[model samples]
Target: MPGRTGARHAVVRPPAAGRTAAPVAAGLVLVLLVLVVVRLPWVGDLGMHAATVQRLRHSPLDPGNPLVDADTPSPYYSPWMLLLGTVARVTDLPVFAVLRLAAAAGLALLVTGVWRYVKTLSAHRAAPALALLSLLLLWGTTPFLWSGFPGLHSLALTVSYPSTFTLGLAFHFWAWLTRAVRGAAGWGVWLGLGALWAVILLCHQFSGVVATAGAVATVLAARPRRTAWLRPVAGLSAGAVVLWAWPYYDFFALFGAGDGLEPVHRVLYGHPVARFGLVLLGVAALVPRWRRDRRDPLVVFFALGVLVVGAGWLSGHYSWGRALPAAVVPAQLAVALEAVGAGRRRLRAGWAALLTGALLLGGWAQAGTLGYVVPRGALPQALEDRYRPPWTGYHWITPWVRYGDVVLAEGRPARQIPAYGPYTVAPGYPDFFLPDEERRTKATGTYFAERTPESVRRGIEREYGVRWVVDRTGALDGTGLRAVARGPDGQVLYAVP
Candidate 1:
């Protein structure tokens, strides 16, 4: 699709009035840039997602309950996984490899989306470049500078998350909506928006809500004449809700109604100073221009998104709150860039060079730190490689563990052990939000905290159908379980005798 400015059906609007035209080359470079930045495949969500995607490849229509042994139905909707898995199968690459490629594609889309969003919002020449640079740099500023380590949260969204990619798709949806408001969009655009709506929901529920809310807020806050587009907006949203009714019902029934789970007080993610700084600058720039661009849909969208996200955080909705940074950073950057670009004549070249230098240096440092922490393999190579050590010997466990054969494990290993292999943890709830109180209580009381080895074994067998115990600390020696395999580090797989 050709770039169109001013919501007219014009197809020849370049990014700026007089920029060189190498869009294809630029796209290739952006993809290469993203591929280089995202070197590793595995991350926090990849294990479960990859495992699920791999399964869905075999049975694309029905990825029957991933966490249980029986054919228990699940409410999860994973169009992202289905698509990624299809790509992997077609390309004959490992699921992890395909995920890496997907990450690169997502990065490219985000870059393109950011540029387009800025172009649609402002006529400033430097806005697109500045926005793109701001987004790509210093995502680890808060974590790295404050805590001396790169944060996993930013990396997860940028490299592995389905919702992260949706940021781009969401922006594209916004652009089409902008066109729709001007009566320039066709039925095809409306159909496309509907498809994007479904894609966002199927990818990540939290981000999906965020996108919907942003669009709704923008539309509702639109000037009177633009409000006509609200019909399509409302129709698209209601259609999405109706189509995904079952999944939504299941999600609320099991996951959203967090009745028994302990109140999670900690924020899973944080705003990196570099990114937040850009948002602050955007807000500052937006203020002076408020009189002129007050009615811009993108302007209203950002304004409302900032307010809503702030309210969510203050209200202790941390899951959604934590998502705000990834959800709004790109748009915020565009706003700031446009603000700055509008006054380019007053902007100093020295300051621009300085800002660019700082962002590039910050990106380099974060990438170096990321490489150190990101482990190798779907499971860590140390754990996967055989004959390295008894601790290293556990890599063999995932394949041997039969489907629904309940196992006992914890931490990262626990999340993957069941998905990569057929085994399910006693309390192997795939989604932490969808807690099975009974199963969790049983595991906590009898299996994880048993006073004696015999009690632990008995509790496992009775409550969880657990036949294997993946002990990392060599603590299950006297539990009447044989050490089926042991790694060099002494992590052992104990079979119930």
Candidate 2:
């Protein structure tokens, strides 16, 4: 019913920037991130973590969940992982549910990083709209913006939580590197970051490498200013030095073995080409960007990281996770360059179009993963269809829970925790095998850590308010715990005294 003149204007001119409807795009990105975390983590390794937690409480002295090393310092190597198990038992929440929440939070932080970077560059302009647009645009790219969700396929079809963490570190590194490249006093940031990278390498080795490399590349790309090359060489050299030492030993010391020199394959640098395509394309994208913002170190660091990591992946030394950090930079950068200037308008428009295309393709695949989303510490009560038993119906007892080690039992059976069963024979738990040090590493039994076996046992007894040991698993034969319960296909759950 509008007048022809008003209608004519609608066709003649796009709505004013103020009159333009606000995009639901950013909200959609967040929603997608949440959904991805829920669905993918539910099906991913988080289940294993939860199962491990359940076993600890269900069988405090069981060898499978050993705290003390039967032989080494500790029986199991996943001490950091056990913290989550403890959290699961202490809060009585589902472990996977908690993991999902954490993943979602990381995704939010990444979005914040991009928004902050954009504002830093254009604080005087319409930062809010630009920030929101940048975020939405980045979120739209596949393999570029990982969303850090469990199953959200960001470019490269790579997946994992540490990937997002690496990306976050990349943002911080870019800021400092840019200043450093410009001859600004920014060595402190690089040094501090390198130390932090060492810690990350210890926990999730690949993440550290990707973060370090990506940061350096972004720095160089940001300004590409030739500054004695000493800055980057020194920063990267420190990281290399750390990688060569620490976990193993000082590399130089190994050569003094007189008659020894072991040519061990570097596990990290193993895969190279497989990770190159996305990396190469990203770097290629930046070829023209150098003129737009020659001072931004983030672009340089990201470019180099991607190229080098991609080369590593192809060489069979790189892992997908290691390359993940670098890919996300281009995702954000593409959005950042879109509003540069008039001459570059078409190029920016094409970049936006291409990113939009990639996102549409990824979204098509993500459609299948929407329903499986569960939190880290808890599962939905309506598992009337999810699991078989022992692992199913368990949800009714607690709103949130974690998973523990899943054991597979073979022939003969074995000794187990007292809470896990009625023990009368030598094969029975708590009475059969002695807790040996060598066996601690090899033994499936996981009771107390060598550090505080007595303490942990006592604590377990006190925490659960039970004098009896409860070993819960599906295996038996050796001194391993037996499965007292099971799923329909015959997956059994054992117990001990």
Candidate 3:
């Protein structure tokens, strides 16, 4: 009888060793991420963000196009960047240093926010840790690095982006909303949540969409009481008010401006199988969740995300691909919840093994992210092979290129020079708000054409206040501009005569 009773108990409860291991593994992953944040290696869009901070620091109220000298308002001027800009101005810290600080704070918020939100889903002690690990590692073996996605490699690269900070806030917002809608809460809490929703939208519009989808799923799954229904309405009203009252840029105009963004975002739809194949496991996990409760929050959230992303692909509104997280995250969390909350002993063990295998595969695929913290040469041969070199910036031109000086350069230098407080003849990234963007682009191209008349080149120089020129070696050797410095990759910086 004692032996039979012990077997039943073991089947009912998870092993103590497994429970202890989950948290330890989670802690170690977070520590590794912190080291990456400390290194703060340059990658995609870092230049644009750094330049945005530089502009905001110098002129907060009127900071214009981040990569050019236009006076037009920019969408990048969010509440988070404003705060970081203030820090830069007051402390006189380099923009990248301030970015490192931002990265650390964002990482902390993300960690705590995940913990709080997962707690609302399950009382199981291991659920939060498992959820964190699942969120970071349940993607396909192919490494998909992007701003809004929080896969380990992507998060490491975009730790400093507004998307990270805003996504962190979104998790907290969802947690608070879940609790507020379920329990009796005052009108003030609802109104505050509404304002927070607006702030999240303002901070990173794409993440805001993801947050909104999750919010709807939360409310739907909760099936709040009739009295609680009015609270969401009041909260939404407050959010609309905040969005309207924001003075930096017209928030509503963004809805109609997706046309210009579609081209670049089209790439997000490529390689559907390679980028997200492993997530199907989570989808398989969702079947049991749906069977148990048809209106499961995770299922509802995944449905909504699929609705948006699928529509984006079909309708040519690919920019909506940013909402991929809405679908991806709920599925990831469902797997974690199942691993911890499964009822049958064999079923639970099966889920545990599957999740463990997926995580190991995903971690190895992103092992190259370790190169961000350790030297590339020091990485194991396999990791080094996977590692990508970060952008080598145009800091060499800083000695000659003063603040706000317009440089006529067309490729990578055009993208990177603005980070050091100089503007470029053409903005490296797309600029929907800049009225003369087309004209400036033409002027830059005309200046660089080999057969252009010297007089026409000089005219181009005076038109945009082009103080410097950066291009390939000997590209403009006879243009009469004084050669200021030569940088890596055959880039030459010339002072306009």
Which stretches in model 3 have alpha-carbon errors above 4 Å? 1-13
Clashes of each: 11, 110, 0
Q: Over 4 Å off in model 2, which ranges? A: 1-23, 35-40, 47-101, 118-163, 176-191, 222-284, 290-303, 306-310, 318-321, 324-328, 339-347, 373-483, 488-490, 494-497
Q: For residues 52-147, write the lDDT of model 3, one tens digit per residue.
A: 999999998888888988788888888999999999999999999999999999988888999988878776678889999988888888889899
lDDT of 1 by residue, 1-497 (tens): 33336632222233442233223323443554554455543434545655665666655656555554444444444666677767766777866667677777666566667676666655545556655555555243432221111122254334555655676666666666655654555556666677677677666665666667656644554453554565676558655664556442244454453322224413433544653443354454455446655654545656666665666567665544534543355344544344344333335343344455545554443443333233434434432331111111134785556645667776556666644545455333434433463565456445545365675557556666778777775556666678877655567877876
RMSD of 3: 3.8
lDDT of 2 at 127: 32
Top-down lDDT ranking? 3, 1, 2
Overall lDDT per candidate, in order of appearance: 0.53, 0.40, 0.87
User: Candidate 3 has which clashing residue pairs, if any?
Assistant: none
Order of candidate numbers by TM-score, starting with the best: 3, 1, 2
Winning candidate number (lDDT):
3
> For model 2, how does the per-residue alpha-carbon lDDT over 1-497 read when each residue is reduced to its tens digit?
11121111111221355223223445565675666565543222333333334444444334252322121111111323344446655776655554454465456655566555544343323333433444333332122323332224341122224445445544555454444554445666556656555544543444555556655554545444466565566666676666455522233342233221112223334243432222343355555656656734445555565576566556644334335445544544544344331234467457545544544543443332323343322544433233222122222212111122222221122222211222211112121122342332233233422333444434443433332222233222243333344434443443432
Name the weakest run of 10 consecutive residues (lDDT summed) in model 1: 385-394
Each candidate's TM vs. the true structure? 0.76, 0.53, 0.96
C-alpha root-mean-square deviation, candidate 2: 12.3
